[model samples]
Target: MMHKFLMSVYKEMLLLKRDFGGLVILFIMPLVLIITITLIQDSTFKSIHETKIPVLLVDNDNGQISETVKQNLNESGSFEIVTQIDGKTINEEVAREAVFKGKFQLAIVIPEKLSKDLQLKVNQNVEKILGSFGMEDTASVAQKNIKILPKEVKLYFDPATQLTFKNAVKSAIDKMISKIETQSIYATFQDQLGENDAPLFDQKSFISFKEIVPKVNDKEIMPNSVQHNVPAWALFAIFFVVVPLSINIVKEKSQGTLIRLITNPVPYAVVILGKTATYLIICMIQFFLMVAVGVYLFPYFGLPTLDVNGKLILMSIVALFSGLAAIGFGILLGTIAKTQEQSAPFGATSVVILAAIGGVWVPVFAMPKVMQYVSHVSPMNWGLNAFYDVLLRNGGIGEILPEIILLLLFFLLTTAIAIVYDKKKREV
Candidate 1:
């Protein structure tokens, strides 16, 4: 039985070798695809964090608030504060025109007397609070009942700017302004209570935010485009094996090779296993080559290097199961298809559709809630999750076992259906 299975595997290998050009294309094209996609996506990721956007600033206030805003914007390292254009200082009108005409993506105008009005408002509120607490004279609070109008800090956005970008900028500026207002109120209270008295409260932030990610060997392994794209596109390329594998099987059937194999004394399951093993080998090769490119070649292109370090074994386990699932699907597709034309196009299109809905094109979380639920049906999603578990989450065998089991079950189910379908056809 082992000898017959080995012979079956050898036959498939020989057939693949005969179509050497197609085989080479299968390997080369995926590498090209992964590299191109990683480069494009890495640039986008860098643009959001590493690249500073140039923003027009109209500092009409030129007071404490405006100065603080300018200083903070520069310190944030996300924006380049452009105060002048053509050697002329920009005012609110010029900034507005520049942004509206798309000369700049964003413009921030600090209204005149913003600091003064904000201070007056804070002082009045503080005096009222102190009076209510019996810490200040009620007569003095009643005498200064003048209301202060709110100051407007205008923000202009380019017509072409996306709504998300606009909202992000607005949210950031609003937080900064709120912090400034809170500080001003604190300062006013201190002045009213006399600086000589013990400090009431610390003006600095009591709470802050810090991002936490998975760690390896006591060092943070931040997830980057390389870590993400390598496994994702590798799995995509792995499943793409369905195309050629299905076409080969369909070709065998049309040419009577499958009929000859069926007539042989060897069990039918051995023959199917042989084909599955051959294609699984091809899938593994594709995955490792992609990982090699991500680790070695990506850095040359100014992209982050993929670090597989200790997770190579777990990755291989996921890739092996994913390959089996793909091969099972290919075998089933070839069994059902009548010709190469039917198998080839449908195999390719189905892989693409599976990839699309499976968090390959867009993240499942980013998809609409309905689609997110729908994505669970795609085997590709299971494979991708297993890959992410190993790569990003730094998961071990125990953590990735569920997805691995799903992939294995998918392989078994599809292969069983193919065998049953073929048997029924032969009986007829």
Candidate 2:
């Protein structure tokens, strides 16, 4: 039985080899696509990394603090602040519209009386702190308790934009606010300290908290473009096996070869198993070859080479699961498709739709909430997520357990349905 299965597998390979042109195209097209896309996206990411995020600043306050905020943003080298154009002032609504229209990634509207409001906020904080510390009777307490109205700056941003840009803008704004408030506090403290000359309060021993982000190792970071494209194109190419696989199955069925095999002494399951094994081998070859191009050929194009972090075992597992899912999907399509015309459209269209929904064309996070929820059912999403977990997140096999299980379940479910359909057809 095992010998017959092996022979059947070899037969599948021999038949595939006969269509050498299509097979060669299948292997070459994904490599070409990955390289081309990586090169194209390289320039975009490079521009973002080399240049500052373009932001529009609407300074209605035109005050010292607002000017200082604008100066700080420009000096920080993270943003190119556009305040006005052609001697025309930009308003808050225009800034908001610019962000919404993608003219700018961020828009900041400095409200009127920003400096005064900020100064008032500082005084209120000092008064509250003094009261909490039981220093309400202090001579400076009455003067500090004078509260000023607070106003908020309106910030406009597209929620769908990348979070990194938004966070950078937010962090810069936070630092600007901190600086303004600290300066205010310092001025108030000097006035109060000079008057009170409190001997009980040890100014020299004052402790303050500081925030710092921990440093990451240089080798730990992978370029986002490389990480995304490598797995994305690989997933696309592997699933594309559906076309040829389904076509072969349809050809055999229409030619009466499958029926003849069913009438022969061999168990029908073994022949299907052999064909699946053949396609699985093809899937692995496709994966490794694409990875080789990424690791070897990409550096010549000024892109980062593929780095697997020595997780070959986890990588292999993902590839295996992806292959199984693809083969199962192909089998299901084959069982349903009665002719070449039916198989071609169904197989090709399904793969395209699945890839689009599964985030091959766009990141799932960037998709609409409904589509993102719907992406969960796509096997390609599971495979891509598993790849990203390892390549981008530096995760191990255990981290992708859920994805792995889902992929395996997808394979089993689809293959079972196809087998049931095959059995019913044979009985008829």
Query: After aligning candidate 2 to the native by TM-score, how far in Å is the CA of 119 from where it should be?
Result: 3.4
lDDT of 2 at 183: 72
Model 1 stretches astray by more than 4 angstroms: 43-49, 91-103, 133-147, 158-164, 196-198, 210-212, 264-268
Task: Encode model 1's per-residue lDDT on 1-428: one tens digit a residue.
Answer: 89989999999999999999999999999999999999888865664558889999988897999999998899888999999999999988899888889899999999988998888788788887887888985545654677778888899999999888899899999999999999999888887887747778698788999988777679986678888899889989999999999998889889998888878876668889999999999999999999999999999999998888899999999999999999999999998999999999999999999999999989999899999999999999998999898888878999889998999999999999999998898899
The TM-score values for the models, in the order shown, are 0.89, 0.71
Candidate 2 C-alpha lDDT tens digits along 19-75 = 999999889998899999988887555544366777788888878788898788777
Output the number of the TM-score-best candidate.
1
Error of 1 at 264 (Å): 4.2
| Model 1 TM-score, 2 decimals | 0.89
Q: Which ranges of candidate 2 are over 4 A from the true structure?
A: 1-7, 14-21, 36-49, 58-63, 83-103, 106-113, 120-175, 182-186, 192-223, 260-266, 349-378, 385-413
Model 2: lDDT equals: 0.83
